[model samples]
Target: MNRTLTNTVKPDVISDFKEITKMRLAVSVVFSSVAGYFLGAEVVNFVVVLLLAIGGYLMVGASNAFNQVIERNLDAKMNRTKNRPIPAGRMSVTTATIIASLFTILGIVVLYIINPVTAMFGGISIFLYTCIYTPLKRVTPLSVFIGAFPGAIPFMLGWVAATNDFSIEPGTLFMIQFFWQFPHFWALGWWLYDDYKRGGFFMLPTGKRDKGTAIQIILYTIWTVVISLIPVFGVTGRLYLTPISGVLILILGIGMLYYAFKLYKNKDEKTAKQLMFASVSYITLLQIIYVLDKFIRIWI
Candidate 1:
């Protein structure tokens, strides 16, 4: 009876742990990093790619776990986050801390084996996400701006992992993702303003869900679209997009811009939600287009 009960209870623990680490979120970040790796690698090493994915997931997971630990109280106040492990009383702080520390150490070790620069960027991402962005969320709207730095790193870090260099190419990748995040997150923030306020997070630039915030989202959407096209000019070192890819990315960006404009025109929660979904689609499709273009160039 005892053995059977323990077996049944284990799955619950696993689910709670996964919740604390934000597995789906971590996986999306890993996908971006993997795309970067493929773009920068001249000859892909499957083993190194595997290490990068594992290490990236570990680092992101650790950061998320730490964030939950720090924000357990605040999380409990928010409807969306109230069910998280720490906030829901499903996991102890001590257990979460141990898991986070283990993940951090293991992640860094695996990345370091690839290259010191890769490991260094991974460590910085975790520190910024957990130590800086987590606390700053309640203090100022600029927290989202600061958070974009670490958020953008995975795209560039994967490039560094592939090339083992810090150059204009990686910087371009970083810049693209960095700009993309503003509109993406701000739109989501607009839709979830009430929930975010419950947890004392000020994610929107204007600190209110109004025309001002929507305007900023629109402007950043424009910038994101423009900057994404820069690589097609052949100015960003090794990062060059062919005109075909550029047009596809342009179409994708325009789709995001359309929704951003709708949010601007309406300033409504439903439009903001639509913009949020469009932003997600924009980035994912853009990444796919980029990888496909790279492979096309290689084949030709």
Candidate 2:
């Protein structure tokens, strides 16, 4: 009986550990980093790209674990988060802390091997996400704004990893992602307002799912679309898209805006959910487009 229980419990523990790290979200962040690497790299270094992906995932996972540790009690109050490892009592704070520490240390060391700038940005991303944004979620609506900085870091960090420079190109990538998160997160906040309120988190700019919130989402969506196209102007120096890719990005941006408009008009949970999914699809496809356009321009 004891041996059977141990075997069962061990697998459960491992699953819970993965949950605490928010593995899916971490992996997505790594994908963005990889896209940035591809966009910036003239000669792709497969080994460095691998390291960036690994390091990016570790830092993102560590940030999520730290967030869970700090918000365990708050998380327990939200239906969506109550089943998470920490809130569900499936994982202890001490264990999570150890995991976070190890990930942070290893992630920084791995990035530093590529360049100190890459490691510095990685550390800053973790710090901003865990130390600042996590607690600010309960204090003010600006937490989402603060969180966007760290959220945008992976995209720029990839460029820094490739070139070890913080120039106009990476800055443009950072801005594009920075504005994109507002609409994306606000749509999610709108749909999950009740759960977030129950969790004592103030994520929406307007503090409620009203016209004010919807308006902000639309505005940011516009800004995101505008900034994403700026690179095509060639003013960014190292990163410029061709006419075809620029049009593709414009169409994708409009697709996201269409959902944002629908959410505004309907002001319902269903519309908000659609907008949330659209936001995800928009960013992912936009990143892929940027990478593909980068190589296509060379071939053409």
Candidate 3:
């Protein structure tokens, strides 16, 4: 027992946690889950919300850890990912594998305690992100859509976790994130096209910085704004966009669309980067606006 204990694994648990979590990505996903919960939850259920947050983080983090493990070699070829913990040799493949499995199991169990639907989505998200997305990246640009399905789930998962049911409200959340991905992701594609190319990944549609891709970005940006305002209409089938909230969302969406338009018109690296920054802020702000609008209605 002592000899086995001596040989038992010891790691810099702190750094390993950070590395396995893709700390920044997990943080962003958690914020989205919280916002989605607030936006859709009519009654605040602190316990379920907390579970969803932690479960969402663990599941998403596991996805990222497995991705890094699979792509360590390809990541080493790309400037952006060359310094990742896996490729940079700070963490071993064995350690990463164990962490990924534990997170998935723990995350699903937590979500299951909240509600079966939450568990289902969380499980599928981890599966899609790892089994589907990780490999698709090396195969096709269509992987973006496949990956977006999992990426877009956080928005809806929060709503379902809160209501213990799936409904159009969560669907609205899903659509917003779904449409937002095109411009947001394509903008990153523009900025990192070269780095991605070095890794043999064609992320951009045009496969080159050209008018076609720019036009596509503009179109998707517009679509993102359009769907975001669906809550304002009385005739949208259970989803009504109140006039005031509609206007606020419109302004926010237009703010984002304007940047997308600028990037399309300019087709320069700086413009593309600016659009990417705007898109990040745009989604975050949109979620804030949604939650605020929901609260404002009750208060007013």
Candidate 4:
């Protein structure tokens, strides 16, 4: 009886935590910081990574909180997000607001200690996502475009924090992530267009499933692959591309595009889900490959 009670109660507690901090969203944000850090840091700094992990959580969590605050009603109408804390009435607006505010302020402070540049971008991402992008979602499908700015920042945020400057390296990282977002999110929009329609979100250009959006996905997927190879070409300053790594990246790009075209051809929910999953794998693997390539080059 005691063990069963603890297990049941534990889920409730975990769900509450997810609601408060938007754990799923925060995990992505921290990843950005990690990607950025690895690209910029000349030497591994555990302390910096630690601070970034926590601070990135707060910054992304704040955005997630505010997103829920604004979209609480809309979320309730969607099956995918219906159980979210705010939509489900599990957390109050007032408490969520306070928690978000505290996290934002605390998170920025932590990043500021690392450097003004990291803090500046961190602060900007929060403002853009919460203040600009969140409101824009209801008004325009272009909100996804606007949101990409903040979304792409985390992968480059570490470079600024470690180097305390904006340079081509971080720019490359930002651009890579920026292009990656369109295909990834568009796949999601395709998958969840039904739910989104109920909430008045104009996610697809056609406002219905069609080839136009799928073509855009293929274009972006192509662009994403092209950009992934730029660093290996040694053309981007502070970024170099070697032959072996180049071949590996090309193969990976093909994998992503294969699935992208599959979605484009079928335009079914299952294909869209596969493309979405493939995209996640693409980006995460790309980051890992970049780090590995760096180690190989340095070692060689």
- TM-scores of all predicted structures: 0.97, 0.97, 0.92, 0.95
- Candidate 3: give the clashing pairs: 231-240, 231-241, 232-241, 232-242, 233-241
**Cα TM-score of candidate 3:** 0.92
Question: Compared with the true structure, what per-residue lDDT tens digits does model 4 show for residues 189-239?
Answer: 999988988888887655667889898889999998899889876877876
Candidate 1 has what TM-score?
Answer: 0.97
lDDT of 2 by residue, 136-156 (tens): 999999999899999999988
Cα RMSD of all models vs. native, in order, equals: 1.1, 1.2, 4.0, 1.9
Scored against the true structure, residue 4 in model 2 reaches a CA lDDT of 98
| Consecutive 10-residue window with the lowest summed lDDT within model 4 | 200-209
How do the residues 1-300 of candidate 3 rate in per-residue lDDT, one tens digit apiece?
876765553445566578678888888888898888887677888887788889988998889888988888999999888877888888889988998999999999999998899899999999998999779877888888888889899988888888778878888888899889889889998988888888888678777789999999989988999888877775444445567777877887788788777877888888888889889898888888878777877798
In candidate 1, what residue range of length 10 has the lowest lDDT sum? 16-25
C-alpha RMSD (angstroms) for model 1: 1.1
Summarize candidate 1's per-residue lDDT along 164-241 as a digit string, tens digits.
889999998899999999998998899999999999899999899888988899899999999899999999988899
Candidate 1, 64: how far from true, in Å? 0.3
By summed lDDT, the worst window of 10 consecutive residues in model 3 runs over: 233-242
lDDT of 3: 0.84
Which runs of model 4 end up more than 4 angstroms from their true locations?
A: 1-10
RMSD of 2: 1.2
